[model samples]
Target: MQTAAAVTQKKLKRNVSLAFFAAAVVFSLWYINFSFSEFIGGIPIFMNFLFTDFLPPKASDLPTYFGPVLDTLAYGVVATVLASVIGLVFGFLMARQTTPHPVIRTVMRGFISLLRNIPFLVWASILVVIFGVGSMPGIFSLILFGSGFLARVYAEAIEEIDSHATEALDAMGAGYLQKIKHAIIPQFVPGYISWTLFMFELSIRASAILGLVGAGGIGSQIKLTMDLFQYNRTSTVICILIVMILVIEFMTKRIRERLI
Candidate 1:
């Protein structure tokens, strides 16, 4: 009877706490600087941009975009390839189970964390200075981001695998390479492909934005048109880009589904 009473008291306390927290959130939302009024005030501006600025898109710019489109696709392909290779190496090295060395794993983890957190823009800026402004900087930045992301994913995937499989490989007098090739790689193939696909998707967006820094791609054309107040051309360019991205995504999805 005493224990039952205690449980009821704890439940009541938790309910009261949650109720207060919910009330506080409701009050904050109603009175905060980020209230719906802020969005309401911007509706007119959004309407003007959508109705006045984006209508009658200049479809004439489509022809001129072929080269830039190809360049962007090429950039994504190259960056994804490089990132997959680098990420695999780093991921394997960083995996605690794979490394089995405290210091080395710590260092690798730190490096991955650093690369993951730093924005691609910052890397692009640094690369621009060193590589002297071109597609290369964009490619390098994509490589950095993609590699970091894939490395983390790969490492986590490795950590989730069956320890027995690894032990079996080890019992056969297998070295690290042999254990990975026989035990790890086969199981990792699907996850590796998935990560590569995701990185390719990310690289596509990164490649598009690289043109903002003169990294050379379709983004440069959009930037130039927007700077000149050629809104129609910019709108048309975005439309084309959307269609291209959708097509690529569709094709990739089909392939991945088949493969998986």
Candidate 2:
């Protein structure tokens, strides 16, 4: 049904977009001082450091890391739950259909965007200065980061819901609260759960390094070990982090598969 001119124009637009994407990649590499030759030259040295210094992970240190690692897991779980609750409220405000006013929606969108743009490390640093070096800063950092991301995801999921359901409720003389309770909440549950699980997985990884900024977690252990040239202990910590991440990823994938 499409005309030849339309097809040609579409192809031209696609090519232009690809060109711009390639240009952006090149620019980013240059801006970051990425060098293929340097990377190749450093491969041997990197391998030597990895094998000689970090090899034979100190299994004995496993017991030492248990407490901090548990702290990291707790941070991830608590942050994920807090963020989901906050994001759920903000998400309704962000969604086009659910938002009460255009101005409020726009403002909420901008605030969420700002939260997403700022790195968790930056948040941790600022909060650490305010809260004074503890798990509180790290927890708040994950909450801020996860809430912003999940809000956007939740907004999109809300937007994609079948409009007819809301319309039918409206026709039935349903109040806004009733319509949302019956229609939106039911439809958004699966997507919200999936996104929440994904965010929890990410928070686990983030919490691991949060301690380096004095926010408290396994990252402090990593930093301390590295500073003392105790690479073997650091390697053990790294292994635990890798295993934790892998397990979370696997569990989330299976859960999502079942839910979705």
Candidate 3:
């Protein structure tokens, strides 16, 4: 029967896909220099840092570290807000809905890719040198990162929207701004909000690391404690960061569920 033949073909295709995937996995491991000894060698250093350098967290310096935590939070919030706003405008420009120019879309997409390709640390490092050790570099780096990501997602969301609705709006002679404000925004509000929260969650983690170059967060606190050989305080800071991350994760999950 034709059904039997089709089923056999599907099975054959599946087997071929599995073979390719299995080969790729083997090739990846071989190419990457993966070794058990490499992992074993790194374990002890981590153990030493954990057991000797970071045990019995000291709570004495809580007051001193408080300011830096607030600074980091402020940096993340400011950067996220700025990124979302800029992304809104740029996303409109980047979306082919308004422009419909292939060249512009390609350029915008390429720029977004470029922004995401560089590691944030590398961008933060360069920014620190140009701006000099502070929250400004951290915030700016996040803005660049967030704007690029949001612009692409926003463009895709716009493009995927119902054409009939857009057509109806066009028949009414609605201006581009009005059409976008009335039609596009309402349709995409849920997705936009979800992504914005997602970005904030990422910002929370990035904010912590951004302080490494003196961007002013718990990272700076960790650096300071390490410099002073205060492993106890460092442990406390680490614990606090872990809790903050968990709390943010929980909050984001709840918000996302509610939005849905």
Top-lDDT candidate index: 2
* Candidate 1 displacement at residue 23 in angstroms: 10
Q: Which ten residues in a row have the lowest lDDT in candidate 2?
A: 207-216
168-254: candidate 1 lDDT, tens digit per residue: 988889898888888988888878887788888777777657778877777777788889998888888788778878887887788
Point out where model 3 deviates above 4 Å. 1-38, 41-45
lDDT of 2 by residue, 136-243 (tens): 999999999889999999999999999999999999899988988998999999999899999999898897678789788888888889999999888998899899
Which tens-of-lDDT digit does each residue in 103-205 have in candidate 3? Answer: 8878877888798778777888999999999778888888888888877777777777777777899999998888888888888888788888888888889
Candidate 2, residue 154: the lDDT equals 95
Residue ranges of candidate 1 with Cα displaced over 4 Å: 1-38
* Candidate 3 Cα deviation (angstroms), residue 53: 3.0
lDDT: the better of candidates 1 and 3: 1
> What would the TM-score be for candidate 1 when compared with the true structure?
0.83
Q: Ten residues in a row with the worst lDDT in model 1?
A: 29-38
- Rate residue 241 of model 2 by lDDT: 89
Worst 10 residues of 3 by lDDT: 93-102
In model 1, what are the clashing residue pairs, if there are any?
A: none
Tell me the whole-model lDDT of each prediction, alpha carbons only.
0.84, 0.92, 0.82
